[model samples]
Target: MVLGAVVLWELLAAFLERTMDESVYEYLDFVDATDSRIPRRSTRAPGLAKALSLLRGDGRALLFAGTVFLVGAAGSAGHNFLLWQLQDQGSSGLLMGLWVGLGPLAELALHPLRGQLLRALPGCGLELLSLAVLAAQLLSYSLLRAPWAALPVQALSGLSSGALRWRLQGTVGDVATPGSERALLALLGGLCAAGAGLGGLGGGFVLQRFGLALLLQASCAGLGLWILFVLIVRSRLPRRRKINYSRLLAAESSEMSDSEEENEDWLVKAMRDESFNRNWIQQHGIK
Candidate 1:
């Protein structure tokens, strides 16, 4: 059923893309033509070596990647232990399915509030909050005895997993150069897979030897330590201002279309003027 849903979603996206107005593509082309800063699409795809070189050269990107790897590891370990713990407590298959389903439902509930959350907490703040929520979930799982109790704990997955995924994408876009976005994202994906593989392997060994409780507790402790380390390092590092790409793109698009500019909503007009756009981008510390 899940696979079917995913397939349907992809088909829907492809349909929408195909049916979209050609003028929209033209406008995007105009924006790219006008904006010298916009990275041109490269003919050759970036390789793994290029992606690794990006991480090596960019300190902030490297730090973010490390955090992602640790989060993936801890998250994978906790998830495996959660199912095992539930089984040990004699949870029915139906209850286990419900527990797993609740996470995505929680994420759906939070989707409407994502913009507000992003506005309220910029930079790595949201990412840190997600990690903290994950830690709490881990701690709760460690102490869980009742199968039903796992449902509520799994709901935190929305904030921890969903929000982390969102912020990680934004962070990557912010740090990535024009042509490196795909490569960087691919690198992060590989890192996440590696982390998950190791986590499952080591977690299984620990679960067999030390039991589920110790596995959960130790994963929680390790994650907590990582959170603390990130906090310290973040405090010491200079903060980089993030660009609101959506707004910038909208403004640029509106400016490029003179006819549309006059009919644009008030919000678009706010940044419609060239001077205003420049000032806005500058204020956001974009070169």
Candidate 2:
């Protein structure tokens, strides 16, 4: 059923891609903006096809999807779990939403840095740096005494989310191409969405069982556990067989929110140039 619906949707999208008044490039731009991980492939057929390919390719596709799903699950577990606990921590509804929204807001401040980081470093290094940032955010939660202090933590969410969002696409794009890859990509994306939702639920339940402070303490513990998982599972993964840093970056750039993408474009351009990126990365030791 899942695969069938995707085929139907892909057929519909392909028909539209071919016949729509909008040119395919423009239509692709819409898709890139709407779901950056949708891949800038010339067509939507790959969303399903790639998954099929992955299955045929050493049985690695499903493993790749499942592995990332765990990471996504871990990520959602941390975020949703924390958000729920924070919301229940003696705050008003407005304050709760504002606080929860802070993670993306945090991204607003650090995206430039992340783009630079991705451009200069090995993929493992990028993953480590991103993980480090999230760990710091979790550390903040552990140390925070007042609810207001938690606002700063949300800023980290921006980086956390931005990194995950783009990396998710780049990862999917890296493995599943040939246009028909969209099925796998979309399914992976869908899993990420589902993982985050489940993470939220699990986080809330953990808090209910352990109480807020204990919940947070456990959350921190989980982040550490995830760090270990990254070291073991992520750091050791092979490089993308055909790593297109430029294309990978575009996959990421296209996914940025319109305003956010606009904000990041200058940075993207600067980083893409060899001289500019070298100096920039050197100044920050981004690698």
Q: What is the C-alpha lDDT of each candidate?
A: 0.81, 0.63
Candidate 1, which ten residues in sequence have the lowest lDDT sum? 38-47
lDDT of 1 by residue, 55-84 (tens): 887666777788788778888877676787
- Clashes in each model (backbone N, CA, C under 3 Å)? 0, 18
Every model's TM-score: 0.69, 0.56
Tell me the tens digit of each residue's lDDT in model 2 across 1-287: 99999999999999887676347545655766568655444544433554755656733344445544545655655555555555556766777778867666777767678667678764545545555666566667756666677776776676666776666666666666444345665677777677667766776686678755555555556656656765676545564476789998888777776669677897787667978778889999898
